[model samples]
Target chain A: MMLELISRNILHRPIRTFITVVAVAVEVIMVLVVVGLTHGLVTDSAKRVEGIGADVMVQPPSASVFMAFSGAPMPIKLAGKLQELKHVRYVAPVLLQFSSSGRLDIVYGIDPQSFALVSGGFVFHEGHDLQNPDDILVDDWYAKARNLHAGNSMSILEHDFHVAGVVEHGKGARLFVQLKTLQELSGAQDKASVFFIKCDHPDDATAVTDEIQQMLPRYVVRSLKDYMSLMTSSNLPGLQIFINVMISLAVCIGFMVIFLSMYTTILERTREIGVLKSLGASKAYIVRVVLGETTLLCTVGAAVGAVASFVITHVLVHAFPTLVILIQPEWVFRAILIAIVGGLMGAAYPAWLASRRDPIESLAYE
Target chain B: MEPILETDNLWKIYHIGKVDSPALRGVSLQIMPGEFVAIMGPSGCGKSTLLHVLGGLAQATRGSVLLDGNDLSNMQDAERTQIRRCKVGFVFQRFNLLPTLDVRGNIRLAQHIYGNEFDPHRFEMTTNVLGLSHRLHHRPSELSGGEQQRVAIARAIINEPKILLADEPTGNLDTANSDAVLALLRQLHRDLGQTIMMITHNPEAAAYAGRVIHMRDGLIVDGIPA
Candidate 1:
């Protein structure tokens, strides 16, 4: 009977109920999308880096783990020193340049011969590998996203380059160019942002990494296998805080909307509350009714938000093939939990107010 | 016989801002078991206030209300509420039916509030006695004024409370509906032996009660057997 009354009361005001549900749904979506996008980007980037087939990596001193943020600060000759290390089979000097012409991208400058030794070479899908100063290699995803093909001339960083080939994705960066050409264009001549090293055996990666770190104590040296393990949001600077701030904002939105909705509902049903009290409803019973109504709204909103998140993610990924958004089951469940907690918190005061109302005054309420 | 409900020098003062307005002023009353008593008074004469105090819906400023020998005035709010839930039922002037609930839901709500197991026989008997068996599935808005009052009456008696406190149960009905509700109350008092305390301004409505108590200026001025 109590459940019937609560459900009827909620159904009695459809517009208000819908608005409140939508507010909670928006909160859920915000949390899920924010967490999903950040996690997806990080995991995807790390996987691609691991796919580059490098056993060990060496960067300039104090370099960021995010390769896109690294500058070409290390001398190109550092590749020779890494090559001379015991158990090191090959060393590839790569220059990183950030581009934001039409879209955000990180361009990798690599010496094809050395890069092929370290990365086991790109599997070309359209044309041959880099053979000219202005030749550019794009991965399959980037080509599909930008509608590019071999022999297509594309302008990047205010410079035009001939599309040499489209290769399989998951190699480090989506766009690749000649190391010398990128170095000359970026005015970082004879400079490399990082070095990718291939060891004689996969099991020797950790030893090779230790040797590189000892040679340059201040430089960032990491085995690629270990680097993949460190690709979580917490390991990335500012990402976790950003996720936290987004989640907090979403919770605040859900809380405020539910608070207002329940408060006004209590006020509107003042006489109804009086009737309930007259019928011997306890304070706890009144609180349960109010909170029950909120829980119902939040549960519905969470379901809608979860479904909407998937739909929106699908649409986004379809429109932008290069964009990665992973909606994990754990995060979806967490988002629902967050929305429900926020909604209950929002309803607390209003439920108390309803329970504390004097039966006579409530009955007389206009 | 001992009184089913008794009030000793009941006083109810309304605190309006900085002033105290006394609604019930040292008014004492009593009603025996199975008696249909009517409290007749003009507006502002505290008839409703007396009912509220007797039903344990509101506390008195200075008074003691004993329902079946329990001092409601001396009890805590929860205790009073428990008594109200178990031993008292109320019927308001406006029908006061929960608009969202159907007639059956409203009656079932009272039983649920009483925290008792469902009594299917009693529910069917009460609804049948009130002629509300057909209207049980209808919302208050769909029922007529008299039907709504009947639903309210059924709800009040479904728990078989020790006393029924009604504040102008027919005030919002037409003449025919008022007479029908009055007859129902009288039947409940005589046939079911239910104790009823009703407040009204209409002598015709008061005529249905076995006794009448008249109030003026928040105090009883006359008491006589019909």
Candidate 2:
């Protein structure tokens, strides 16, 4: 009967239900998109770091964004010094170059055999492997957009290298080249931009990174996960703040609209409630009836909002390729909880007022 | 028969700013257990106020109401509510049926007030007796004025209260419907031996009761056997 009463109340006002549902849906969609952007950046950056196959990254001391993004050309001799460490099986020097178009891309030069060891499954898509000094492997995303593939020639810092083969990697930008070739072209024969170290034991990565950082206070070292977290914190904070504000605003407005709507309903039904009271319905029972109705409205509205949010997010992601609004299972569950809490909070005072009405006065009400 | 409801010089006064007005002035009456009584009066004669005081809906300014020898005037609000829930049933002139609830729900509402479990068989029997079985699922809006009165009867009697109070039960009905409703109340009195007190202005409606008390200026001017 409680459930039945709830259903009847919701069915009583179709227009009000529609308006509340739209409000909740807009809020949910905004929150989902914001959270998705944050998660996507963090997770994607982590995957990219893992693909680079560096257990740790060493950069200039106290250099946060600039060191990672700027990748200042370091002496190629650093790899040789790092290779002398006992746990280090092989060390590959990497260079990151910025094109005249201002697009940033990664370039790594290492022995093909050792590259496979450090990069895990990273390999050329076609053409000869990186055995010769002039060979370079470009990631598929970069290759497709730049109209450069295997056998095509491209210049980095006005130094030329042949694209030996195309490669596919994690969904981040990348371009690979032989170490000696990049060193010769960039006029950094004695320098390497960054070192990609392959350790015999993956667990030894932190110890190696720490040792390198300690050895040279001028440089910084980071585990792949930390690097990803740092990247997310700096790059995605604005989107997170925006989403939080949007969801908070929606909830506040939703609470007010739903609260006022339900209150007016209770006011109109005061006589009926009084009649019920005289008939033997307790104050608590009356409260339950009112709350039951609100819950039904909010639950149905939130469910609809969830589905609408999914559709809206999918469309937006398609329109803006870089922005993906992921509605995970957890997000759906949280939205439902929010709706229930919102419904209860909205209905409480109105139900109280209705229950407190005198039976005689209520029956006397027109 | 022993009196089921008795008031000793009940007085109900209202204060409006600096003015004091009395709705009931030292009115005293006793209603027997199985009697069907009516209080008839002009507007503002305080017949309704007397009924409200008797039903515990309003407190007396200075007096005492006794139910089965227990004093109601000194009880707390919660205690009065309990008494009202368990022993007193009320019917309004407008047939105060909750519009959102169907006939069955309206009937079950009485038990809900006492936090008592609904007895389906009792509900069915009450509806059957009230001739409202066909309208059990219909909301108050769908019922005619007379049918709404019948639903009110079912709700009032569903809990098997000690007394049923009706305030102008037939005031909204036409002549034929009013007669039908009055007849139903009379039948309920006969079949269940239930006690009832009704307030109305219509002498024709009052004629159905076993006794009628006439009031003017908050005082009873006449009492007659129907």
Candidate 3:
């Protein structure tokens, strides 16, 4: 009977219910999308780096795990010293440049022969590997995103380069150019941002990494096998904080809207509450009715929000082929939980006020 | 027979800011078991206030109220509420039926508050007696004022409370509907031996009761059988 009353009360005011549901849905969407996008991006980037087939990576001193933030500070000749190590078969000197011309991207400048030895070579889908200093090779995903093909002229870092090939994706970077050309363009001549090392045996990677760390104590040396574990939000700087702030904002939105909605509902039904009280309803019963209505609203809103997140993320990934949004089931559950907790907190005060109402005064309320 | 309901020098004062205005001033009353009693007075003469206090909906400022020998005046809010749920039923002037609930739902709500499992037999008997058997599914807005009051009465007496308190139960109805409702109350009193205490100003309505108590300035000026 109480459940019936609660549901009927919610349906009594359709417009108000809809607005409150939409507010909660928006909160769920905010949390899910923000977390999904960031997690997807980080995981996708980490997978691509592991796909380079390198057993060990060596970066300049104080360089960040995020390659885009690392400038070309290491001399190209450092690759020679790395190659001389016992388990190292090849070392590819690569220059990294951050580009923000039409969109944000990272450009890799590599010496084709040595990079091929370390990465097992790019599989060309349309053309060939980087052959000229002015030639550029774009991965399949980037080519589709930018609508580029072989023989198309593309500009990067204020230099025009011919599109030499469209390679299969999942390599280190989306756009690849000759190391010397990028070096000349960025005024970092003979300087490489990082080195990708291929080991004589895959099992020797840990030893090779330790040896490299000993050789250059201040430099960042990591084995490729451990890269995936380091891709989490906590491992990345500022990413977890960004997620927290977005979730907090979503919580605030859910909380304030639910608070106002339930407050007004109680005010409008003051006489009804009085009637219930007069009918022998206890304070706990009144509280249950109010909170039950809120819980129902939030549950419906959460389901809608979860479905909307999947739909919106699908559309987004479709429109931007290069963008990846992963909607994990756990995050969806967490988003729903956050919305419900927030809504309950929002309705707490209103429920208490309703429970504390004087039955006589409430009955007399106009 | 012992009194089923009694009040001793009941006083209810309304504190408006700093000014104290008394609504019920040292009024005392009693009703025996199975009695049909009417409280008659002009507006603001403490008729409704007395009913509220007797029903445990309001605490008296300076008095003791005994419902079935239980002192309600000194009880805590929860205890009073429990007593009201188990022993007292109220019908208001506005028909105070939850508009959101249909006739059946409104009636069942009282049973639910009483913490009893659904008693289909009692529910059917109550609805059948109130002439609401066919209007069970109708919302309050969809029912006539008379039908709504019948639903309210069914709800109040669903649990067979020890005392039924009606505060102008037919105030919102027309003369025809008012007569019909008063006739139903009289029938319930005569057939089921239900204890009823009603508050009304209309002499015709008061005539349905076996006894009438008249109030002036929150004090009972006349307490006699008519």
Candidate 4:
């Protein structure tokens, strides 16, 4: 019966209840979208790193910038030395050169069989194998974006080459070409940007990475996992600070609107609360009644907001493909947490005000 | 037998700045079980304050209110709430039935608070006695002022409290509904032996009770037994 009374009370004041719910929903949506977008970006970036097919990464001495942003390249001669080491199954030399359009373009030159082994097998849609030093498979995005189909000729660093086949993979660049073609075009002969070594055993890979590091103490030799961490850690500090500020700002504003709504609801129901108390409702019971009303409003509002935000996020990403904002399960969880905590915080003052009022005074209040 | 309600040297004072306004000045009274009493006073005579003190809803500046020989002043807030839950019921002139609840739910509220199930027969009898049988499904907002007061009465007495406190129960009703409510209260008192202490300023309202206590300012001016 007490629950029934509370339910009816909330239903009776539809306008006020709805307003509070919407307020909470708006907050939840904002938090969810923020978390979703950032999480998606991190995942996509990590996948990009993984696509390079290198178990370990080697960089020139004092190369502090990561592969994604670094302009420095390891000398191409380093591949033969790394390949000669024990436990090294195959080595593919990779070079990344900036396109005239300023996009990151990668070139992989390998003995076709060795390249196939490290990068998984490649399927050519139109062109011959990578045996022709000038043939290459470009990223699907780069091909479609430049209107270049397989067998179409394109120039990278002034050297001409035919597109072997358009490819899609999580690693390497979104754009790919032959390593020799890229190097010849860029006027860098007998020197490559990086080397990817596939090891015979997973455990031996770590030992190989450590040995390579010891051999070239001046250079940085890192495993694929290490490269991923470095990439995330480098950006995490800035991203975390940015996300925290954004979330805090959203919560503060959301709380203000929600608090106003709950406070007004309480003020309007002061007499009713007095009656309940006079009839033997304890302070705890009274708080529960009020909070039950709040919970109903917030949960509904947040759910609606989440759905709306999801659609909006999809639309935005479609309209601006480069934004790369994503929505994920973890993001939704964070949104819910924020909404609930925000609802409680918003309700705190009003619940206190309701509980603190003298029953006699409230009953006598006009 | 012990009295259902008792007050010993009760004093309630309201402070405004440095001025101490006494609402009830050392008022002491005992209401025996099954007795129907009315307290009459002019505006600001502290009748309502005294009722609040005795009901454990307000604290007195000094003195103690004992309900069934248990000191209200010595009880914690939760304990007082428990006492009010099990031992007392209230009927307000404004018919403070929750507008959200229908007549049935309003009446069921008291029993539910005690975590007790409703006795449907007892509920039916109470509603029939109060002439609210047809309005059980209607919310308080849908009922007339008199009907609403009747619902409030049903809710108060549904728990079968040892003492029923009515603060001007019929003060907001028309003559016909007022008489109807008073008739119901009298019948309940006589048939079930319910103890009632009602506060009202109306002389006719006070006359229905077996005893009347009149107050002036903060002190009792007249006390008469039927």
Number of the top-ranking candidate, with DockQ as the measure: 3
Sort order, DockQ high to low:
3, 1, 4, 2
Better structure of 2 and 4 per DockQ: 4
Candidate structures ordered by TM-score, highest first: 3, 1, 4, 2
Sorted into a CAPRI-style docking class, model 3 comes out as high
Tens digit of per-residue lDDT, candidate 4, span B77-99: 78888888888889998988877
lDDT of 1 by residue, A1-366 (tens): 778988998899999989998999999999998899999999999999898899998988888778877888999989888889999999999999999999899999999999998899999999989999999999999999999999999999889999999999999999999999999989999999989989999999988988888889999999987788877889789999999999999999999999999999999999999999998888888999999999999999999999999999999998999999998999999999999999999999999999999999999998
Tell me the tens digit of each residue's lDDT in model 2 across A103-167.
Answer: 54555555566556667656567666666776677776567667777898887756677888877
Off by over 4 Å in 1: B224-226
The lDDT, on a scale of 0 to 1, for candidate 1 is: 0.92
The DockQ assigned to candidate 1 is 0.82
Give interface RMSD for all predictions: 0.7, 2.1, 0.6, 0.9
Give model 4's docking category.
Answer: medium
| Candidate 2 lDDT over residue span B1-226, tens digit each | 6689988888999898999999998888888988899999999999888988888777788989998776789986556677888888888888887666788877776666666687878877888888999988898899999999999888888788889999999989999999999999899898998899999999999999999999999888878332
lDDT of 4: 0.77
Candidate 3's TM-score reads: 0.98
Q: What is the lDDT of candidate 2?
A: 0.75
Would you list the C-alpha lDDT of every candidate in the order shown? 0.92, 0.75, 0.92, 0.77
Residues B159-210 of candidate 3 have per-residue lDDT tens digits of: 9989899999879899999999999999989999999999999999999999
| Ten-residue region with minimum lDDT total, candidate 3 chain B | B217-226
After superposing candidate 2 on the true structure, give the runs of residues whose Cα lies further than 4 Å from its correct spot: A63-80, A89-117, A120-195, A217-219, A225-244, A317-322, B68-70, B224-226
Query: In angstroms, what RMSD does candidate 4 have relative to the true structure?
Result: 4.3
Q: After superposition, how far is residue A366 of candidate 4 from its true place, in Å?
A: 3.0
